[model samples]
Target: MATATATARAATMARGSGAADAPALMLSGVGKRYPKFELRDVSFALPRGYIMGFIGPNGAGKSTTIKIIMNMVRKSTGAVKVLGLDHVALETEVKRHVGYLGEEPHFYEEVTPAWLGGFVGKYYPTWDARLYKATLERFGIEQSKRVKTLSKGMKVKLGLALALSHRPELLILDEPTSGLDPVIRHDVLAELMSVIQDERRSVFFSTHITQDVEKVADYVTFINDGRIVISDVKDDVLARWKRVSFPLPLRPEARSASDPAGLEAGVAEARAKVEQAMRGALGRAFAAYKIDGLTFTGITCAFSEDVAREVGHLAGTRPRVLPVSLDDILVAIVRGSEAC
Candidate 1:
C-alpha cells in the first residue's frame, strides 16, 4: 500500500493541479555515443499518472537511457523533458521534481540509515524526515543498522525510502527488484501501484522483468541494441501481437526445410515456403515465421479474423491464433529483427 505520507507529499510536489496537458516525460531523438555501442534516436513518452515500463534484455541501453533522463550521463544529441521541463537545461529543478533509484544504489556503507537519511535529506528542499522515518519502519529496516550489513532487499528499501522522502512528481526507478525474491518483489510492485493514487505522479520503471511490467505497467517501451523496438500501451501491444501456429504440410519444399543440408539453408527454405503459402493471407499484417520440425509458428502484430481465415484457406492448414504475452512478443520481435 502507498503510505499516506507519500500520497500527500506527491500532491504537494505536483507542478499544478490543472497542468495535465503536457506529458510527464518526452524524449526526442536522444542519442548517446560510445566507442563500441551507441543509443540511436531513442524516443518515447510517459504520460502523466501512468507507469511506463522501460524493458529490454541485458545491455539493451535501459540504464543508459535512465542515466540520461537523470542527467547523470550526458547525451550526444536530442532533448529530454521531465514534468514538462527541459531535463538538462533545468537539471537542478528536474532533480528536485523527480525522484530516482538507480539499478545499483550506492551509499556510504559505514553509516547507519539514521545518519545517512540526515545527510541525504539536507539536499532535497522538500524532504520530509517524518516520511523517511515512516518508510524505514514500514520496510522493517533498522534505522540504526549500518548499510554494509543489510541484505540486498533491505538496501533497496533504504534507497526507495530516500527517493520517496522528497515527494517528487516523477519516479524513475531502474531494476529495483531484479535480484529480489518473490515476496520482496511483490512488496516493491505493490508500492508502485499505490504511488500514483492521486493520478498526478508517474513512474518510469526500467527493468528486464516482463512479468513485473505486465503486472503494473500501463505503458511499455521495448528497447534492443540501443534502439526503441516498440512503445505503446501494454494492452494495445498485447492485443495487436499474436501467435499463429500451423502444421507444416508434408511437401518437397517443406521437406528440404528440415533437411541436414545446412540449418541456414534449411531455415531459409522453410521461411520462403511459409511466405509463399501466406502470400495473400497476410494482407496488411506483417508476420515472421519459424519452423520447428513439422510446425510453423508465426508472430504477427496485426492479427485479425480475416487474416486467420485467409491463412487457413491459403496455407491449406488449420491455423490457430493465440493471444501473446509480453515475453512472447519480445522474443518474436528480437528474433525477427535479428533474422533480418
Candidate 2:
C-alpha cells in the first residue's frame, strides 16, 4: 500500500507541476571542462512556473551547460536533475519532457512539417494532437510545407510547435531569436509567453540577446568563460552593474599636471578625459545620482543607477554614483575577466 501510494504521488506530481516539491531542473556543483575552456561549479534551480534566461558571451558555457542537461554530453562532475529524475539515469524520460531548439536547427530536407510532426510526435505517449493542431493553425504553418522550404523564423516556430504539442513539462531553447527580424522575434516572444499560461510549465532558453531576456525571462543566469557568473532575476542583474567617473586634482606630479590650468581647469580636463574613457570603456552615457560630496563625471543618465555605484567601487576612486546597464555589466565582467 505504501509503495502504491508513493508511485501515485510521483505520478500526480509529474502530472500537475512537472515536479511539485522538486525543481523542474536542478544543477548542483556541475562542471564540464574542455582543453581551453571550462564550465565550473554551476548550480541553479528552476521551480515550476519560472523562466530562466541563460545569457553569456560567445564561447561562454551556456551551450555546454544546456548540452549537459540534455544528456548530449556527459558531465565531468556533479549532478543534473530534471523533473526530479537523474538526467543520465533517466535520459529517455527526461528527453520526453524537454523541448529543445538549436542556433542552427536541422531537419531532413525532404521531410514535411506534417511528416516531421508525425515522426517526432510518436515518442511521447501523452502527446496532444489537439494542441499541436491548434499551434499549427495559430502559427499559420502549413503541414505540407517542406522543412527546408520554410524560412528561419518559420522553422523556429515549427520547432516550438513541435515542442509544445508533446506536452513537455519544460521547454529548453538555444538561441531561438538569433537571426530573425524584429517582427518575427516579437511573434516568437509572444508565442513563448503564451506557453507560460499553464503556470506549471517552464522555459529555459540560452541567448546573448539581453533585450529578449529583459523582456520575457523572469530569472537569469549569466555564464562566461565556461562558468556561471551571475544568476538572479533580470532586475537584480541590471541593478548591480553601473558606470562612474570622477575628477583628479591637477598637481604638478599628477598625470594631468603638465597643463597650466588650476584645479578648476583640471576639473574640466578631468571631466572630458573621464567621459572619453568611460565612453570608450562602457559605451553609454553615465546616469548621475545624488550623494553628499560625490559627483559622477562622464556619467550618462539611465535607469540602472545602482549599477553605476557598484562599478564605481572598482575604479580605485569612488567618483560619482549612477546606474549601470546589462551591456555595461557585460563590459565590466569582460574587462575583469579574471574576477569571473
Candidate 3:
C-alpha cells in the first residue's frame, strides 16, 4: 500500500535525476533472528536492469529475506535499500513503483476478479485497465468468477495479472510459479522476460525452481540454513563449481581374522580412509560426496590447476570433472552445509 504524499515525493525525486546509476536493490549484512531459526550476515545486490534469482531450499530464509525487503517483516540488523531509497524510511514511495506477488495471495472469497481489480487498481496511478483486462483474458481467468471458485493455478494467474498491470519499475516475486501448470509457468516466465527488456526495470525472483532461474537470471544468490553461501553472477558461479567422480579402492581382506565381523570392519576401515583422502584433497571447498560400492562422487567449488593436481594425487589418477548445473549446485551447497 503506497501513500499519495510519498508517491508524489518519489515522483519529484525522479524528476531531479541521477537515480539510475544506483542498484535496484542492495542488502548489506542483513540478519534476522527468531527463536529457532536465524538469517545471518546475508548480503547481495541486484543491478538495475538484470534479474537476480534468490534461491535456497525450503526453510532457508528465502521468504524471510523477501518479507524484509517489502517491510512486511522487520530486520534485526543491517540495511536494505530499494531503488536507492531506504526500504523503511521511504516505504510507501518505494512500494509505489514496486510490484509484488506472494506465493499465496489471499483475496476476499466473495469478490470477483473484475471487482478485485478495480479495488486494487486505485493504489497505482499508472494502472492500465486495458492491459489488465487483456492479461486476464490471456491467462484464461474469468473476470466474473468469484475468488473462492478459482483453482490454485488460476489464483496464481490472477495475482500475476494484478502485479503486472501497474507497470512497476521493479518486480519482486516470491514463488510466482508455485502452483502453476507447465504451460502457465512458461507464459509467466515469458512475461517476466518481456518486462526486463525495458532497461529501467528489474526483477528479484525468489523460488526453489532452479530451471526457471537458469533460463533467465543474470545473477544468483543462494542462502542455506539461514545464511548466504553463494552470491555471484550466474556465469561465474557455474564456471567455478564442478562435479568430480572417481573410482573407490577395493575393500581390504581380513587376513589375520576368520570372523565375518572382522572382514566387515576391514572393509569399513578402507572406505573411511578413501573418504578422508578425498576430503583432505578438497578441504573447505568440498561441497558434497557420495560413495557407492565401487565409485565415489564429489562436488567441489575449487576449480583450479592446484585443486586438480591434489585430486589427481589422492585418486592416483585424474578424476572425471564435469560442469555442474544450477540444480546440482544448489543441492550440493545445501547438503554440504548440513554436513557441517
Task: Please give the lDDT score at residue 214 for candidate 2.
Answer: 81
RMSD of each: 6.9, 6.5, 5.5
TM-score for each prediction?
0.84, 0.79, 0.84
Q: Weakest 10 consecutive residues, lDDT, candidate 1?
A: 12-21
Tens digits of per-residue lDDT for model 3, 1-340:
4698678667757653225567889999999999999999989999888899999999999999999999999999999988888899988778888889986799899999999889989998778899999999988999998999998888888988899898887899999877678887898888889889988899998989998898989999998898998889999888788888776543445535578788667657657877787556355566777877656787778777787777777666798989999899888876664332
On TM-score, the stronger of 1 and 2 is 1
Please list the residue runs of candidate 1 whose C-alpha ends up more than 4 Å from where it truly belongs after superposition: 1-20, 248-275, 278-287, 315-318, 338-340
**Per-residue error at 173 for model 2, in Å?**
0.5
Off by over 4 Å in 2: 1-5, 8-10, 13-18, 244-260, 263-265, 268-322, 337-340
Model 2, 33: alpha-carbon shift in Å?
2.5
lDDT for each residue of candidate 1 in 1-340, tens digit (9 for 90 to 100): 5798677646644643223457889999999999999999999999999999998989989999999999889999999998777887778877887889999999899999999889998999889999999999999999999999999999998999999998877999999889999999999998888888858888999888899999999999999899998999999888888888877544555455555665556556656777676554363475466678667777788776777887787557779888878887777667653321
List the global CA lDDT of all models: 0.83, 0.73, 0.84
Question: On residues 1-340, what C-alpha lDDT tens digit does candidate 2 reach at each position?
Answer: 9999899878875674444667888999999878888779999888777788888888888888998999888899999998788899878878887778876778888888888887888998778877887888888889887888888889888888888898777889988988889998998888778878878788999888878888888888877787777787777666555444553423334444655445456556545554454544344443332222224443343325444554454334555545655665665555543222
lDDT of 2 at 160: 85
RMSD of 2: 6.5
